[model samples]
Target: MSYMKEFTKGLVKENPTLVSLLGMCPTLAITITVQNALGMGAAATFVLLCSNIAISLLKKIIPSQVRLPAYIVIIAGFVTFVGMILQAFLPDIYDALGIYLPLITVNCIILGRAEMFASKNGVGASALDGLGMGLGFTLAMLAVSSVREIIGNGSWFGIKLAPDFIQPMTIFIMPAGGFFVLGCVIALVNRISDRNAPVRTGCAACPNKDGCAGCGTDSDVKEAK
Candidate 1:
C-alpha cells in the first residue's frame, strides 16, 4: 500500500484521460468552459471513489460472468446519486454540467479502474487508488479546458483576462477544440517520455536494457529459472 504507487499509477500507467484514454465521451462533450470541466471532474471523482470501494468489497462475492453488468449498476447508482445531490445543492454547477452528470455511469474511467485496479486491491488501497486516479483525471481535464478557454474565450475561468484580445479563436471552444487539445497533450507526453527514456545497451535485466530500439521488446527478456 505504498503512497507513491497510488499517486503515480493514475498519472501515467492508468491516466484516465491520456493513457487509459477512458471517459472521453463527456470530456469532449461538456468541457465548453472551465466551470463545466471542474464540475464534471468533481462529479466523476465522487462516483469513482464510491464505486471502486463498493466493487472491491464485493469482488469476492460477485460472479465473474456478471461482473460487467454489476459494475454498471453500481456505477449508475452513484452517478445518479451525485447528480441529484448536485442539482439540489449546487444548481449552477449542476446545470452547467448538464447531462454529462448522468453520463458518468458509462465513463470508461470508472469502469476501467473498477475492473483493473480497485476490484483487485483491498478497501483502503482501492480508496486511495480512486482518489489518486480521480484527481489525476480532474487535473488533466482542467489543463485541457484551461488552454481552450484561454485561447478561445480570451479569458481564464471566465475572468476576462484580455478584455480586447481582438476576437479569440472561436474554434477552440468547439468539438474540434477538444480533439485538438487531447491529441496535443498526448503527443507532448509521448515526446517527453521518449526523450527521458534511458539510453541502453544490449542487456537483459535493464528495463530498457533489451534495447527495444530496433525490434521493440527485444531486450526486455526476464530472468529464467
Candidate 2:
C-alpha cells in the first residue's frame, strides 16, 4: 500500500478505538475531561511511535518463540521513558492519568500492530502505521471526552458553557455515562460511514488464523467444526 494509505487508514477506516475497539480501558477512564484525553493520547502516541520503530528494527533478530516477550520489553521501556517525562514536565497530567500511563505497555493497539504489521513491514511503513493509529486513537479519545465534558460538566476543557438555567447531567461524567457515550459515538461513526459489521466465518476466514489455536491444530479445527 502507499504511505498515505497506511497513514490515513487508521483515522477512520481502521480506527483503533472506534472501529477495531482497541484501548477502550484508557479511552473510557481518562475521557472525563479534554485535558486528560489529550494527555493520555499524546503519551500513548509517543510510546506507539517509538515502540513500532524499535520493534521493526529488531524483528529480524528476535526469535519467533520469544517475539511476544521481547516486544513487551521494548514497549515497556518506551512506556517508562514516557512516564518519567510526564512526571517531570507535566505532573498534573501524569497524576491524572495515574496507572493508565504505565498500562500503555499492554495496550492492544501497540501489540497488535507490532505482531500484525510492524514486525512484517519496513521501518518507514511501520512508523507511519504507528503514527496513523496513534492519531486515530487520540482523535477518538477527544471525541468521547468532548461529549462527556460538555454534557456532564457543562464545560469544554473546563470552561463552563451551559446557561444558568441549564443543569449538566452528572451521569455523563460517570462510568455508566462512558459506556453510553462510547456506544453512541460508535453508532454515529457507523452511520456516517455506512459501514457494515464484519462477517465472521470461523477460523479459516479470520485474519489471525495463522496464530489462532483452532486453525493451528487439526484436532482443534475438527472439534470446532
Candidate 3:
C-alpha cells in the first residue's frame, strides 16, 4: 500500500478498537471519563509510534525466531518511557491511567502492528501505520467516552453540559453502560461500513480479514504456518 493508504486505513477501515476490536481492556476500563480516555489514548499512541519505528528499523537484524520477544522488549521500553513522561509532566493523568499505562506494552494494537506491518515494511510506512492506528484508537476512545460522560455525568471533559437542575443517568458510566455503548458503536460502524456485509460465523470462516486472534479467517492460519 502507498504511504497515504497505510496512514488513512487505520483512521476508520482498520481502526484498532472500533473495527479490529483490539485493545478492549483499556477501552472499557478507562473510558469512564473523557480525561481518562484521552490520557490513555495519547499514551498508547506514543508507544505505538515509537515501537513501530524501533521495530521497523531493527527488523533486518532481529532473528525471526526471537522477533516476538524482541518486539515485546522494544514495546515495553517505549511504554515505560511514556509512563515516566506522563508521571513527570501530567501526574494526574498518570495516576488516572495507573496500571493500564504500563499495560500498553502488551496492547494488541501495538504488538499487532509491530508483527504484521513494521516487521515487513520500511520505517516510513510503518511509522504512518502506527500513526493511523493510534489516531483511530484515540478517536474511538473519544467517541465512547463522549457518550458515556455526557449521559452519565451530564458533562464533557469534566465540564458540565446540563444545568444543576438536570439529572444525569449514572448508569451510563458504570460497567454495564460500557458494554451497551460499545455494542452500539460497533453496530453503527458495521452498518455504515457495509450495510450488506455478510454475517460472520466462527473464526475458521470469519470475514474480518484483519488477522486478529480468534476472529481471523482460516487463510490467516495457513499464512502464519
Winner by lDDT: 2
Alpha-carbon TM-score of each model against the true structure: 0.83, 0.90, 0.89
Choose the strongest candidate by TM-score.
2
Instruction: Report the backbone clash tally of model 2.
Output: 0
* Local error of candidate 2 at residue 181 (angstroms): 0.6
**Which structure is stronger by lDDT: 1 or 2?**
2
Error of 1 at 125 (Å): 1.2
For model 3, how does the per-residue alpha-carbon lDDT over 31-71 read when each residue is reduced to its tens digit?
99999998888888888998999999999999989999999
lDDT of each: 0.79, 0.89, 0.87
Give the poorly placed runs of model 3, Cα more than 4 Å off.
Answer: 199-225
Clashing pairs in 2: none
Task: Check candidate 1 and list the clashing pairs.
Answer: 210-219
Alpha carbon RMSD to native, model 3: 3.6
lDDT tens digits, residue span 1-225, model 1 = 596787667766556786556778877877778888888888898899999899999999989799989999999999889888988999998888877888889888888788877677888888888888898788778878898898888888889976693799999999998899878987776686663443543344333221123444443432221
Local lDDT at 59 for model 3: 93
